[model samples]
Target: MASSTSYPSYKQLKEDFVSNLSGGTVSEIALVCAVAPVVSLLWSTLQARQSFFKPYTTLGFVVDFLLNVGALLLSVTLYSAVPILLNLLLLTAALFIYALPPNLSRKKPRLLPDAKSRAAASAGSLGVLSTKPFLTNYRGNMMVVTCICILAVDFRLFPRRFAKVETWGTSLMDMGVGSFVFSAGVVAARPVLKERADNKYIPLGQRLVKSLRHSLPLLVLGLVRFLSVKGLDYAEHVTEYGVHWNFFFTLGFLPPFVALFQSALRVIPSYAGLAVLLGVVYQIVLESTSLKSYILVGPRTDLISMNREGIFSFFGYLAIFLAGQDTGMIVLPRTLKARKSGSQWTMLLTLAAWSLGWMVLYHLSTTYKYGAGLTVSRRLANLPYILWVVASNTALVSGFGFVDAIFFPAFYNAHDSKTEKEAYEASTSRILRSYNRNGLVIFLLANLLTGLVNMTVPTLDVSPVATMGILVAYMAVVTATAVGLDMYNISIKL
Candidate 1:
């Protein structure tokens, strides 16, 4: 286990902050908070309202350009205080927009759903609210935004010191991307899973064929990116897993494992059950043998360490995905009852309690076993990390759900209670929608561009300010191009 590091003193923190600001760290943070959030939130709102793909008006683009320019200036100039304030401002704006009532001028007044009807139907028992699997766009949008943010920092566009391995509340890039893939798999499988019966018969050969067919595209992208980066001979860093293992390798492998297990199991196990079983088995095997040493340092271990984290950890990733599937099963029910505010509050509180409990359990278990605080190892992706990821994700979902519940009436203001249902098939967030439509293209584009930037520009030799500017510009171009392509209904999928 990694030893704990001390928190920095106020004087040290101030010095670090000043140094970072002078070196242009604020610009990256500013871009993440200001530009990324705006894109994410605006696109999500437009998606919810089915107003995306409306031609980009000259006035709208002009306003957006000005806003981004102003945000950049504030970041570069103020450096310290402004970024924090701007983040708060962005959070406020997001909440305001979320809580904003429907356009009453253009639409008729819509009332909140009658909680009394639901409550009476329950006959004094706690009413069951069958919610959609995940809160749809919010989780996916957040994942993309986070991936962008993590990449921004990881590529040295942000201060390199911020990537320090020991920082408190650090979200490692590997882990972030891994979690995103796990969530994506879970969400993607929902359509098939919704109707999958426990007794359904499926030949193993058919499952393998299906898995391979689905995995082939991902495999091609993985090989392309791997060869391209190595072929170009870009600067390579240790990155924990060394140079060969990447997320693509993990992506390429997970589908087959998922297919094999799903085809073999009678019914999918519960999230909690799978997590415990996988984690315990992994830890036991790891503890009982020298597999760790073999994978990490023994001769010619490259084949087994496909994710650069060792082979066992892939099992943990699969478990995480399965947990996500369980989450879908719990939330995505056809017989959804409109929930009252009180019931919604109770649900939110329940989720918070679960997160808190898991957090405490994670810390206690790790401390008892290892005599150290739980370290989230992307390399191993052990028990504590799984618990942490699940808890954090649930907390995020519940918090978003709570907010929507608080403003339920506003969300329903466009139609009557009967008509105001979750729009399962309606998402028009150009940024996220485009990314979703062409996941491989976007990922490959980012990698290809990163390689190009490294080769063409003296990235490591540049000032922090220049680096931030380059990264923001690069990301803006990628995302904007995606949005534009999506506007034309173009998806470059395999």
Candidate 2:
């Protein structure tokens, strides 16, 4: 075991390892974003033809693990070397395999024989809700990418260009925090929309309490992480969040702050407009005043100053959350209605338009001659960063929806509830669903394992093959745990 006297040196070494990265080009980052959907499409295609591959159950699990996790590992590492070729190959394979007919055995039992009966059995019940399997798959894919990158970024094989940018730029890991928050905002739209439609607004105090209750677990986790890092003398990146603050703290306190303004937010006709107003105002404040300096270069004398990055960036993240909510409002309704109305084209067009619109706005914001000349910064989470995160994630969700619509149209737009349900069950990625069901648990486990690996091995000094092997083993453990829990119908929700 390493001695206590050497801990600080190890800390410095690890911190320096990830420092000063400039991140990748926007197109490269966008390509990385496309990886999850592409992999999901491949997995879903294989899953739909499970009857054809029924004899190879063990091979099925292997393929599922590879697509769900291994492909992501490659995206951040090897894919950087031959990105275009790898992406084209995966996509071409997906389309080719999808075109193959599922030769079902006549004697094989159907999973759901009476689809209509099953639908009728649950009719007029709370279970019959407007659901979107693609949304679930999108969230699952995001979690997988996030889990892969957290530890991979520590290895030599992981591309520095894909790591989190130091001050300002785009990167694959930089998208992790913003995208997670945005995904939360996306799902949050359901309840927000429900509240508005039901016209039963909870009291502000009660909402605040509820928000606190929701945030309490995250707060505890943040404290545990902070204490553990300090107690263990772990490698700390002060600028990433702060001296004592972590991502958990950022995630924890955001909800309560947003809850404080829930009433005001309700008054606004559009959440997107509110997001625009907030983002513009926040950007103006950053440009016109010393607030940006206070965050970027200010003295860390007190608690607030020490954690300025996490504190001030709150506004930008809040704006992002709102924008995501608006996006959900736009996209979710179409998804729910598409099943009955078969409006796949409408949903597809809506997603494409939103993706393009946000990307254009992001381009405009970062353009020196035509626009604000601001760069995307995860630390600051400024206007351009917000636009970029929203655009990229929206594009990812759109890609998943497109893949489902194109390759699994029967599953995506079944005419009746029974067929749709049956098709969804058949085509959905079970491992991805497991990850989705217990996201927080998986993330926490990944963090724990990342720390364990860094402590046990010199991640910065490992060879490429060693790095790959370690990462594969790490992800296999994580996914296997998720699958096991899912098999037992266990979800460790926090």
> What is each predicted model's overall lDDT from 0 to 1?
0.52, 0.80
The segments of candidate 1 whose C-alpha lies over 4 angstroms from its true place after superposition are: 1-87, 92-103, 108-136, 146-151, 154-157, 161-170, 197-201, 263-268, 305-310, 337-354, 368-374, 408-429, 492-494
Give residue 118's error in model 1 in angstroms: 24
Clashing pairs in 1: 133-332
Q: Candidate 2 lDDT, tens digit per residue, 27-140?
A: 987777777887877776765654533443677778878887888778888877667776888889877877888655533354475864575466432222345678878999
Candidate 1 lDDT? 0.52
Model 2 scores worst on lDDT over the 10 consecutive residues at: 122-131
Please list the residue runs of candidate 2 whose C-alpha ends up more than 4 Å from where it truly belongs after superposition.
Answer: 1-8, 49-56, 106-129, 334-340, 411-420
* TM-score of every candidate: 0.70, 0.91
Candidate 2 accuracy as TM-score: 0.91
Colliding residue pairs in candidate 2:
none
Scanning candidate 1 in windows of ten residues, the lowest lDDT window is: 17-26
lDDT of 1 by residue, 398-474 (tens): 55455454433333222223333323223223345555556566666767676666567754456767766776677
